[model samples]
Target chain A: MTNPTAAMLVIGDEILSGRTRDSNMHHLARELTLRGIDLRESRVVSDDHDGIVAAVRALAAAHDHVFTSGGIGPTHDDITAEAVAAAMDTPIGVRDDARGILAAHYEARGVELNAARLRMARIPDGATLIDNPVSAAPGFSLRNVHVMAGVPRIFEAMLAGLLPSIPGGRPVLSQSVRVERGEGDVAEPLADLAKAHPALSIGSYPFSENGVTGTNIVIRGAEGAEIEAALVQLSERFGA
Target chain B: MTNPTAAMLVIGDEILSGRTRDSNMHHLARELTLRGIDLRESRVVSDDHDGIVAAVRALAAAHDHVFTSGGIGPTHDDITAEAVAAAMDTPIGVRDDARGILAAHYEARGVELNAARLRMARIPDGATLIDNPVSAAPGFSLRNVHVMAGVPRIFEAMLAGLLPSIPGGRPVLSQSVRVERGEGDVAEPLADLAKAHPALSIGSYPFSENGVTGTNIVIRGAEGAEIEAALVQLSERFGA
Candidate 1:
């Protein structure tokens, strides 16, 4: 079977405005990679409905899974749920499961569940709620799209709960060889090595730190033995 | 004058495949914020030409400036330059200025300028070269779209050379107040503060650490004084 592909949509005005450094993309990327799911694309969009709708539809259509972070909150700008509903052409209302989750959360904390708090309980029709153990507001999964919280901890918790449920392929295995040579010096030989290993992906990442120039040659593929073989060949050829 | 609005397009198959974690976005976001540019959206597209063309046209039309990172290398998969030219409906050829940069670079390194290496010198008609001090291959700016190298350090160096040429408006200033309270508890007061400060953007980013629930109330605007005032009000209202 082909690898299960995924895309991430980070919805927040704060991210676009550079007011917040986005940690969601990195977290999701690492998690999906570990789970053997290929995260194909990630978009950071504002709180605008049009932007969210356009991105959600495009990414959902392209990938096996579309995970969205942010905008599922109690504030006026929190419009991701509505936008996701619109994108899927589904009707949106307060879901019973989500309401129960929120109600139980507030009851345990001895807090009143007001109208704004109810906003978090709303979900698109025909969706399964993803429990947020860190927060009362639960995320929902509709078809291929998983709408989760923007908060790092809650986002992570929700992902941990959700990723195991999906089917995954072979996890991508990678090995890195740090070379003191520049890319220009090693480009030709590396290109040949890449051609030789048709199944493996060889990338040369050049870096200069503290006046030292080097390239980190990363060889990645599905088979651990093949990746190790390629790394061995690279070390032999390059004298690292 | 209104702030110069910008958007970022990140093109790479590696990023989509979860093989590469993107650092260019954060760097560009911080740089744009420092230069007072309003970064509206960011899209990570595959190395597909059609995807690049569609995103380029749409973003360039909407924003004042469009900065793209990645896919401008000498490799066959590097198709961002051709895609940009196609999107702009402009003819692309090896420009003299870029050729000069490439020639000088190859001469210093004592490397033969092959057809693949010369491919880096090809740029669209009526485009200005953005110098890459770190690497010999220069980035180019066609109209308002600045195409830079995919590597973080090189992209950053190219942007440093390019940003100062563009005039910027008032830089966005912000202040954050960490509140050890749930978003539902602080949502009402934050909303009140947001309503009071129409010019400022008030956002609550909920986070949890070691079972402690809290939100970082970030107030952002072009005016430092206004952001400070909002911060003071938030501190008073939220008991920060």
Candidate 2:
């Protein structure tokens, strides 16, 4: 059986406007890849309420699990919670459980908990909280949709807590042979091998550095033996 | 008028699988942001044929301009050219002009141009070639969709040629104030400012480093003076 597929929804105008370079997607990808979960698709959307709601609904339907980062915070722009609620068609409110956690967190730090701060306690119906060890404001999982904070550290923390609970298939393994030849020179044999092994994902990543160009052929599949065999065939065929 | 909306399609299983960090999206986002094009959305899909075609068609139709990265090389896995053709419903073949460029490029370096190398000459009908200065295999622009190589250097080089040709609106201007307070403390004022200035995009990004947490309030809009005014108001309200 194939690994459970996942889709990531990254929300923020900062990411879209290029004000910030996103690192969370790369982090999540690596984590999921190690777990053997198939991360099939990822989308970055602006922090518009309707747009986020639609994206959540669409991705949640298409993939086995949907992980959203960003728009969950204690701010005016932090509309992810409400938008997620709208997407799931569930009522959201400041839950006593979540509020107790926040109250304790703020009390320990001597920080005042105002209406805006309480916004973090507004959890959608029937959702389980994803712990935030970095911060007290918790992320939540509503069905298959795991909503987490946008901050890289918090996102990583929440994911560490959430992933262990989800069922993951055998970790997909990969091996690569970096050919010193240009992609054009290596395309023929590479294509032939790909055709022979239909189950594996063979990727041709071209690189150009110091005025020289070459391709890195990465062979990926669930079976370690299959990947090793493909690597052997590739090395012999390319004669690299 | 608002800036022209654009979407980026990153076609690669490597990116989805977390084997390769996708740099093209960030590179494209920065370029579009500077050119005053609103990069509203970006999607990373696997190297699947039908998925690539559907993503191309969807993004091309939704945005004024669509840029696709990866899957344009000469490998068997490089199916972007054909998929793009199918998406636009145009016939694709090894064009003489494209072949001539490839042939000249190979001949100059004394490299053999074989059948696999010739695959680089395949161009969609009626599409204008996007110059790749780093390597000879040109990216193509069919209507609003611009298909470029996935490699960061090549993609940037192609963009330098392609963006100037496309119509861009006024460049977006932005200013940020780093507030030494948590996001909870800044949300109320942020929401007020966002409501007051509906035209501008005000983002509150939080950070935690060395056990200290702070928020960076960024105000973005087309007008410089407007951003200045917003920054002044934010400074006054936050008293930071």
Candidate 3:
């Protein structure tokens, strides 16, 4: 069976404006890969409501699962919830369950659950809340879209909780053969190897270190034997 | 005046497959911001030809400029040139100028310019070459889209050469005030400050360290004086 396909939508002006470097997409990509989910695409959009809505709708339609990070904080710029709800064509409002979670979290810390903070409790209709052990505000899963916090720790925690419940296919296995030669020298053989093993994904990532250019040929497949065979063939052809 | 909007299209399977952590987007974001070009959105697509074509077309149409990285290498997986050309409705072939550049560089280093190596000379019709100081193969600019190499060093070098030619508006300026308070405690007043300075972009980035949560309020604007004034108001309100 094919692995479930997923896409990520990262929403934040801080990223677009070059103030913050986004790490959630990378983390999610690695985790999804390990969980046997094929992460096909990822996007970063500024904190624009219409942009977020359009991206959400498009990604949700294209892939089996849509994961979003950022813009769910207790601030004026946190418009992701409303935009995502609008995209899903679901009405959204402050829910009692979500509010209760935030209330209890803040109450213990002597922090007032102000209106701005309460905005985090708003949830879309028919959506299930994703627990955020790192913070009080809960993320939500409406349909196949899983909305999570943009903060790295919180996003990681939420994804850990969410992925276990979803069914996954065989985990993708990968092997790499490093060649001490320019990619051009290996391109033809690599192409042939790729064509011969159609089931495996063969990628040549080139790197230059200390004025020496080399290529790392990575072969990935669901089957361990197939990946191992391809690696051996690649190693033989490149003498790596 | 509004800055010219730009979007980035990162084409590579390595990134989507979780084999590579993309630093080009962050580098491009910072460069675009410094050059006064507003980077509105960025997308990472796998090495699928159709996906690259579609993303290039969409981003090229929506923004004033579109920057692409990856899939421009001398390997079978390097399909970005053809894909971009197809998206732009242009013909592509190995051009003499690009071929000459690559041939000279390889010949001087005692490396044979084989067919696979010569593939780097493929240039789309009516596209201007962007010099690659790090390597011999050149990037191209067809219409508003600038297709560059994916390697960090090459991408940075190409961008450094390209940015000077593109006309830019006033550079966006930024100032940040760190507050040792949760975002919810400052969201309301921050919203007011953001509203007060309509031209400035106020962003609240929260961080937690040593069990203490604090927010960094970054104020960005074209005018330094405006940002300074907004920073003063923010400090007065928060006493930070």
Candidate 4:
């Protein structure tokens, strides 16, 4: 069976302005691969309402799952929730369930649930909340889109909790052989191998070390035996 | 005048598969900001032909400029040039100009310009070549889309040479004030500040440290004097 395909929508002006370097996309990609989900595409957009709404609608419609990070805080810049709701055509309001979670967490710390803070409780109708253990403000899952925090720590925690519930395909196995030769030298044989093994994904990444150009040929497939067999064949071809 | 809006299309399966983390996007964002170009959006797609074609077409039509990295190399997996050519509806072939550059470099190094290595000479019709100093392979610019190498060193070098030729707007000026309060406490006044300064872009990024939550308010504008004035007002309000 085909692995579930996913897309990531990263929302933040800070990232676009080069004030922040996003690490969540890498983390999500790695985790999704381990769970046998193919992360097909990722997009980073500034904190603009129309852009966020359009990106969400496109990504959500194209992929089986869409994971979004950022613009879901108490600040005025946090407009992701509203945009996502609009895109999904869902009415959103401060729900009691989400409010209860935030209230308990903040009240215990002697923090008041003012109007600004209360905005965190807003959830789209017919959506369920994704728990954020780092901060009390919860992210929500509106349809197939999982809205999570931009903070790396919080995004990681939320993803750990959310992944088990997601259906996954067979974990893809990978193996690589390094040839201390230019990519051009490795290209012909690698192409032949790739054509021979129609089910596997074979790729070449070139690197320069000590003034010597080399290529690392990576083979990936759902069958471990096929990967092992391909590696052996590649090693024999390159005599590495 | 509004900055020329640009989009980035990063093409590589290594990035989407989590085998490699993409750093080119951050580098491009910072450089564009300094050059007064607004990098409005970025997308990462795997080395699939159709996917690359679709992304290139979409981004090229929506933005004033589109910058693409990867998929131009001397391997079977290197399909970006063809995909980009197809997207622009232009024919592509191994041009003599690009081939001459590669032939001289390879011959100087006592390397044969074989079929695999010669693949790097392919350039799209009616395109100008972007010289590569690190490696002999040349990048190309077809219309508004600038295609460059995926390697960080090469991508950076290519960009440094290419940016000066592109028209730009005034460089955006930015200043920030750190408020030792949660985003909730800063939202109302920050929103007011944002409203008062209609020309500036005001954003808040929240952080937690030592169990204390605080928000950093960043103000950005083209006018340096206006940015300074906004900073002073923000400091007075937050006493930061």
User: CA lDDT, every prediction?
Assistant: 0.86, 0.90, 0.93, 0.92
Across residues B159-207, which tens digit of lDDT does each residue of candidate 3 receive?
9999998988778998888899999999999899888889888889899
Of models 1 and 4, which has the larger TM-score? 4
lDDT of 1 by residue, B89-173 (tens): 9999888888888898888878777776788888999999999988879899999999999998899999999999988878888
Give the TM-score (vs. native) of candidate 4. 0.99
| Model 1 misplaced stretches (Cα beyond 4 Å) | A190-200, A209-212, A223-240, B109-116, B196-198, B208-212, B223-240
- What would the TM-score be for candidate 1 when compared with the true structure? 0.89
| Candidate 2: segments with Cα more than 4 A from true spot | A209-213
Q: Supply every candidate's count of residue pairs whose N, Cα or C atoms clash at under 3 angstroms.
A: 1, 1, 0, 0
Kindly list the per-residue Cα lDDT of model 2 for residues B1-240, writing each as its tens digit.
Answer: 877999999999888888889888998899899999999999999989999988898899889999999988888888999999999999999999999999999999999999988998999989999998977899999999999999888899999999889899989988888888998988998889989888788888888778788998888888888788888888899776
- Where's the lowest-lDDT run of ten residues in candidate 2 chain A? A204-213
lDDT ranking from best candidate downward? 3, 4, 2, 1
lDDT of 1 by residue, A46-130 (tens): 8889989999999999999999999999876788999999999999998888888889989898988987799898899899999
* Candidate 4 stretches greater than 4 Å from native: B210-212
Error of 2 at A98 (Å): 0.9
Candidate scoring better on lDDT of 1 and 3: 3
CA error at residue A237 for candidate 2, angstroms: 2.1
Could you give the candidate ranking by DockQ, starting with the highest? 3, 4, 2, 1
Model 4: per-residue Cα lDDT over B29-118, one tens digit each? 999999899999999999999999999999999999999999899888999999999999999999999999999999999998989889
For residues A1-240, write the lDDT of model 3, one tens digit per residue.
788999999999889877889999999889989989999999999989999999999999999999999999999989999999999999999999999999999999899999999999999999999999988799999999999999999999999999998888788999888898999999999999989998988899898888778989888898899888887887788666
**Once superposed on the true structure, which residue ranges of model 3 sit more than 4 Å away at CA?**
none
